[model samples]
Target: MHESLPISVFIIARDEADRIARAIDSVSDFADEVIVVDSGSRDDTIAVAESRGATVFRNDWAGYGPQKRFAEDACRNDWLFNLDADEAATPELVAEIRKLFAAGPPGTASFWQVRIKDVFAHESGPAPWAYGYNQIRLYDRRVGRFSESPVHDTVRPPAGARLGQLSAPMAHRSIRSIAFHVEKMNRYSTMQADDMASRGRRLARHRLLTEFPLAFLKAYLVRRYALYGWWGLVISTNFAYTRFLRLAKTYERELAARARSDSGAA
Candidate 1:
């Protein structure tokens, strides 16, 4: 009925007790192996994952890319499916993956996952894709690896690697609550700003002024978040705010560096 590929489903998490079970269960029906790598989660995250038939391991936090790479190395299969703690594959997606493996993974190198459908509890269910498309996550470990950035980590696929798109989309349950959204916004913006700092990037005043409004417009109009009504408005505002915050944090860091230099001269 389904195809199996000795595929290993690897998830790197920390304190994800509330949703890790669902993420793991989504793949249990099809994955050959499932592993969860924890990074000092104080909660019962470890216990929950273990109960869900996932082989659990504790590893120190080493940034997103490195931690994911660590899990990638631990996988026994050459094919790896990296899923976020909050992301789950729909049944149709599972069927697609089965079909892909049965037909053989894209000879081009690895598979790029479909832009996950963002789901919210308030709406009927998962919202339709209107606003943005996401990058790839699933790939063959042999030809691709995630970048080792301390903050901005993206998977690097080999040259000429055919990146095929999956027809089935992963469900992205991102907005847990307003409080959680704000916290996540702060954390991710800081991480992004830090990555920019590492690359010696500075914020331009023009960019600082334009980024938020442009981001809001793109999220609301280009991405078509407007179709969702109130939910769309919230997401657009959140996107715009996130853009502003990342630029603001980067600007703050730049100002701090300038102050330090001026003080040294004085």
Candidate 2:
């Protein structure tokens, strides 16, 4: 067997039995250790992770950032890579990472942003010009760590920390189906709404009217979802709906709060 890199790959999961193995397998060959922090999964998530040679720990369901923070602390190595249970590192990405570590520690770069491309349910992989976003997935814990916000699970590198970008992209197999996407969006929107409410954010009435169409245009055109043809339309529509739903739900919370204030005054 080849020597593993001194990197700890951590994943925060819940009921991801069917897909967690792929995430683990993708990094198992190169990473020194794989840490799976499961959040009360009823499925065989823990069993599957353990069978695949992952060190599994059960944490209760916290929000995204906190969950990732928990995983970050649990990692043994200073160099860490965070992969979701539904995502996998492509061979090119793996090779690139391996190359980075070949000649001792990476110079100057404390964190590396990786492009995470979406792989639709029917597709085997991402298209040549797939729409994707970059995130700091690989980093040294001393220089960077996952944010604590419940809704935002991004890595926050210290000021002036040198950041590098990986050319190869990771595959995100997040969408199971249209129904599944909708359900996922619904849950996400609720969390987003709650987060906004906690932060005292209020949406204007005009946002309810313009949110869907504006979001649709942004996703379909600016984000290049149009490249996927009809599938792109479906994806864009879902994306738009998710955005609008969050705003609507947040507005609903505002209205409810106002009603509560009025009742208490009476």
Candidate 3:
């Protein structure tokens, strides 16, 4: 018989000693178990998580989707909530989740999507909430799993699976510093390039030449990043640069491959 467990929260971590504790604590009262899968953190991430009553495990970093799926496999309950180390479940969200389980999860829906709100802490205290997007975090693992893409993976619930949305937003403490944000962009862009190359994808010449401006417009104007002032500009600019980097790296890979093939023919 399946245990009547309510929800199990899973988080994938890597050198997140500075932020993991808060993430774990946010869901501690409501979650049956909090699982943290670390990818060889050189910091005290594992220790901090364990101290907070999280079941910690070590897994070699393969890709974002793979690491998250690994945590899914470790979970004991069917109902799961996937959270990032920099994200926290708000009190309202936690209450809603508890209310969900009290009445029993709906058989109609496979997952619940939640809106995310970006927040920052200044010298004084927590800053005003900033804009954020939505993601499918609460789900039944039997019907949904994260897509296995190396970069920018998301939950892939079935076409017929009923999906619902929640009003309260999850708080995200994103981009702690400009340096941190830069490092993430560089890393994710390289991952995108490698994933594309391994799949035998040829670099799109048109995209290489024109994609950055389109990306910038989408992020800054359409996405309302302009509302945040200079930070919005910086974030939107980073988005554009990442798009360019991914295409540029993919182009380089194609060039190297063609050179190898030509040399062999000669």
Cα lDDT, model 1, residue 55 = 92
Candidate 2, superposed: residue stretches over 4 Å from native: none
Which residue pairs collide in model 1, if any? 108-162, 130-223, 131-223
- Expressed as tens digits, the lDDT of each residue in 1-266 for candidate 3 is 12334789999999999999999998987888999999999999999999999999999988888888899999999999999999889889887777777768766577899988767544222235356688999999999899886675699988887898887888888778878878988888898898887888887699987989999988899777787788779878988999999999899888898899999999
What overall lDDT goes with each candidate model? 0.83, 0.92, 0.85
Give the lDDT ranking, best first: 2, 3, 1
User: Could you tell me how far off, in angstroms, the CA of residue 199 lies in candidate 2 after the best superposition?
Assistant: 1.1
lDDT per residue as tens, model 2, 1-266? 56899999999998899999999999987999999999899999999999999999888877898899999889999999999999999999999999999997798698999999989878889988788899999999997799999899999988888999999999999988888889999999999998888888778899999999999999999989998899889989999999999998998888898999999999
- Across 26-77, the per-residue lDDT of candidate 1 in tens digits comes to 8988788898999999998899999999999889998988998889988999
Higher-lDDT candidate among 1 and 2?
A: 2
Candidate 3 off by > 4 Å: 1-5, 120-129
- Model 3 deviation from the true structure expressed as Cα RMSD, one decimal place: 3.3
Clashes (backbone N, CA, C under 3 Å), per candidate, total: 3, 0, 0
Poorest 10 consecutive residues by lDDT, candidate 2? 195-204
* Residue pair clashes in candidate 2: none
